[model samples]
Target: MTVTDTEVSGRRYTVHNPATGAEIGTVPDCGPDDARAAVDAAAAALPGWAGRTAYERSAVLHRAHGLMLERAGDLARLMTIEQGKPLRAARNEVGYAADFLSWYAEEAKRVYGTLIPSPRSDQRLLALRQPVGVVAAITPWNYPISMITRKVAPAVAAGCTIVLKPAEQTPLCAIEVFRILHDAGLPAGVATLLTTSDPAPVGDVLLDDHRVRKLTFTGSTEIGRALAARAAATMKRVSLELGGHAPFVVFDDADPKHAAKGAALVKFLNAGQACICPNRIYVQRGILEPFLETLVARVAGMRVGDGLADGVAVGPLIDEAALAKMERQVADARAKGAEVLLGGARATGDDLAAGHFFQPTVLTGITRDMDIYHEETFGPIAPVIPFDTEAEVVELANDTRYGLASYVYTRDLDRAVRVAEQLQFGIVGVNDINPTAAAAPFGGVKDSGLGREGGPAGIEEYLDTKLVGISVAR
Candidate 1:
């Protein structure tokens, strides 16, 4: 067994690429003890790492950002092989992840505290932000590199040492991140990567430990709820980026071709594994036919094959479970009388037969009673529904329990502002499919998860506030 193969209790889990079903590598099956050890290491490094001036920490992060850019190609290749996203998309993700590290590096020096005026003459009151100590950061497999960096960058920027628990399927990418930071002169134990197939032991140990002060997780809403409940006992500060049932609303004034193409691009990104991808679309009845035609044309143009292939656009789902789930949702929608406008089943080409490939599908005539209407179809399936009025569409959009992200396309300025304000989603895209950046806040409200990430709000999640007062009266 190689170093990558961490044998814990004589069990090793092998990771394979869903795009081609090829064995990528194996990692250590870490247990509770290993998890605890990672926390201890972080704790041991906390004081030294946190004691440094913000400038010093910023320097290290900047160096890491530089390293990330320099090695982006290798990193992107590794990510594509492990996560099964197209090579172009993987490259973009690597660059985006580097942006987070670079942005937070500068933001670290700007974690400003405020001073307050006291009612009395001789009293002075001030507020200061302090590091939250060791952090337990858990990231999911989809967009593995970006998710880990998004959490890790801010935590480190806030002067908090962290132990990253990356999803089992994408441990190598996480390990590569650590390697880059280590090369950038980040002290050992300041950042640790713990790879494990069984997360229960690690989660239990982290939640039980007082040394771990903050927990940030990116995953499904069900798991997010369980983690939040478990951490409630310890009262650890938590940030959860959970599930999203996003909606893309296109008005009659909008260009049907542009809107349709944008929808297809966003929906098919990462094979629609993104939490914020447009889950449901509400187009004005007048433009529905044109939108559907353009959307089908775009969907039909997408190439589903190995991620490494030059012209391939759509890659495989992460695993058999995801493939089965996509199948069920399609079948459920069909049973409820939804029309399959285009490809509705798995791709049958010889090139994609061994992989977990699903064809990009378009559906119409869907009703609220259908599973595709409410359930998160985290696959390459577009369910388009028609709406008559703005009020009716807004009502339909806000009906879901999730409020992560939403999109709107229209020429009316008043309507755009009105609808965007009325929507309950955390992030809104106006004539845009992508709403994410390092300088902007990312996260959602309601069941989509609590708190925020990115922008100034992100670093705040890793910090605690303290108020101090001084009075001198003789």
Candidate 2:
């Protein structure tokens, strides 16, 4: 009952560690009334928070940034327990989360307005940026802490009060973030945090209320679409960071070992639950053999176990559903003539028996018929599909409905620039595996989602432009 079931009469939902299948904590099952109250609190705090000088708000955010780094160790450990990423990776995520707060602190002061040239000497025209008011931010479970800061920091920096609902599986991480913000001198009611297993009631309140001026969400595309539709009812400003079927293209000129090394590093990150992790890796046919050899060797070296264990390169999948999805993808691939180049099944060991553990798998001979080729595999499975030419590869890569992220590795500058430009993805990495940063725009085009986060573009999402004209006294 503590971690398995959501009872009808129970007021709380328990959170369990996927690494060990043990109960970690419980959170209240918030409903419509709690959501309404949160909106009220945020609305009441808006004028005061928004009225503060950008310098004053920046000071608070700067303090929060410092606190995040000072308490990073505890935060990382807590993330490892709740989100199941390896300890080292969790530490990196905490640092990444802190950078957003730091970046937005500077941006708070940089929210500039412009004075337009007037047609008449006696008249003045001005363009100003104003806070959009209360925001509804919903975050997913993966990279729990980072997602919160990515959305919440920018909104608060723009002087918008927020009501955030963290994913049910990771409320404690959100609670910790609120604590840091409060300690950093953020006024009460400026940010309201809600925990809920039944999200429909809360979601309804957020989308239906005109008081919640904006809605920001990070999750799957299916749910993102639904939320966007709901937000349309009230014309709320919406930002959705949804699913990605990313492609990693490796040209023949690139070193096979280098490409494989980068592939292995990013593919198994958070056990590949990340949206931007490459779903399909396209290596030129001339160099496919060497790349496959190196990739298999590196993939075989990955150690899958509990996140707290030292030297564990890969951690457990979030739950049984994720583990089953991984198995089903592999099963579908094998049934349709895909070859398993490396670990293809669940990690079987006494230590991992209780948890949802999947071995890092590599599949070759991927065809259009295989489920892994057409579907988004948010798990530790790398499907390497060989292509003959740059043109063919680009076509294959861009065939999916998603256009969030893409990667290209090439020694030839011409090919790198050409392929990156023609790829049609929002974020493209040239000879790089990771393309995310606090001061860089991050989002997608097409069905991937709408709006951007991180960098200067992020804070803009929480602001509305106001135009003013005045006639001077004659």
Candidate 3:
């Protein structure tokens, strides 16, 4: 939609449409000066924002949520055109994003502190959670709206100001979200967005700015590492939601059809670009063949086209680089003797071939040594491996450096609970494929990330604990 951010006055960067490789918008490639300005604005606004009562902040966010609901369709369409997710999935993301605003709005007023009695009868101690000052939220492009909402909701709820830098590819959604919140009575300078293509510069600016007391990021592990290192220098509070190679395990007691459906749903959602999407599948030998057959049939049935197209199950990858990466992974797996059970070819059609379209692919016979099995395949590709024993499968699933999310399907509740405990991921799903919810804590362990994103735990990321003591005299 040609969203240019000349309004902010900075370096220019183009946003391209993944489905067509066309420039949909141009935003300011904000530099250090712009970042400094944003930080100054946030700092200027913090005093008043922090002085407002929790109910006041909650009221503003609630109004923002109402605005989001009214414009949900428009935001979803923008996400589809800019982010290359199916229309239905884009709509779902908008709804999910709105839910974060609503959930955190109520959570804002519920920030609870506790009192502890001292051994001495005259002394009492109070523990309180306070806002962590200015927050620098760097979000990814996959779920632009939700990622921003996830970070901003908590920060705002905690009475903290924020300077957000959204991914260059999908900054429009976040910009629009900020605008909506601003319109919903968010005080000027309480929140600001800085768009920049160079992440290094942004990270440096955010790290160097003393006004920025915290940094929250969602992206690649390498970038997360760099940001963490930089933030550590400043001793800024950091919350990272990094890379993942989640395992989707199907036990012998699983329903083949159900497992196949779950695999298809999770693998193709957001073109499998989500950090927590199930990329690696470990199926028990008993139902391996039937599960593979069902998965192949379902993948073959998916309609690959533009995200804006009605009923399109699969959309283009974010860009040519992502498409090339997926192709290389598929080729490497095939070269190492992995069987192509379903679709494996790059898409070719009148308009589809010109874009970043790729068919939903399934690979079997993948071993532990292959890159596709161990690495994160952030595309619409699923690789299935057969395991003989529960212990062996659990070990294999935990072998990767990432421990973001894991899935298991079993009718036996005891076995499901045992396997769930054995898995080292932050979020585990037994029968349901959808593990992410507004009410549940979502994050990762190890290299996947540090800190949580959802539920009550999410609010803690934006808060700082302080203890106060009072003595009573007789």
TM per candidate:
0.97, 0.97, 0.97
Candidate 3 residue pairs in backbone clash: 11-29
Ranking by lDDT: 2, 1, 3
lDDT of 1: 0.90
Q: Quote model 2's TM-score.
A: 0.97
Off by over 4 Å in 1: 1-11
The better candidate by lDDT, 1 or 2, is 2
User: Which pairs of residues collide in model 2?
Assistant: none
Clash totals, every prediction: 1, 0, 1
lDDT of 1 at 79: 92
* Candidate 2 ranges beyond 4 A from true positions: 1-10
Please give, for residues 260-314, the per-residue lDDT of candidate 3 as tens digits: 8998899888888888788889899999889988888888889999999877999
Judged by whole-model lDDT over C-alpha atoms, candidate 2 comes out at: 0.91
Candidate 2 lDDT tens digits, 51-79: 99999999999999999999999999999
Number of clashes in model 3?
Answer: 1
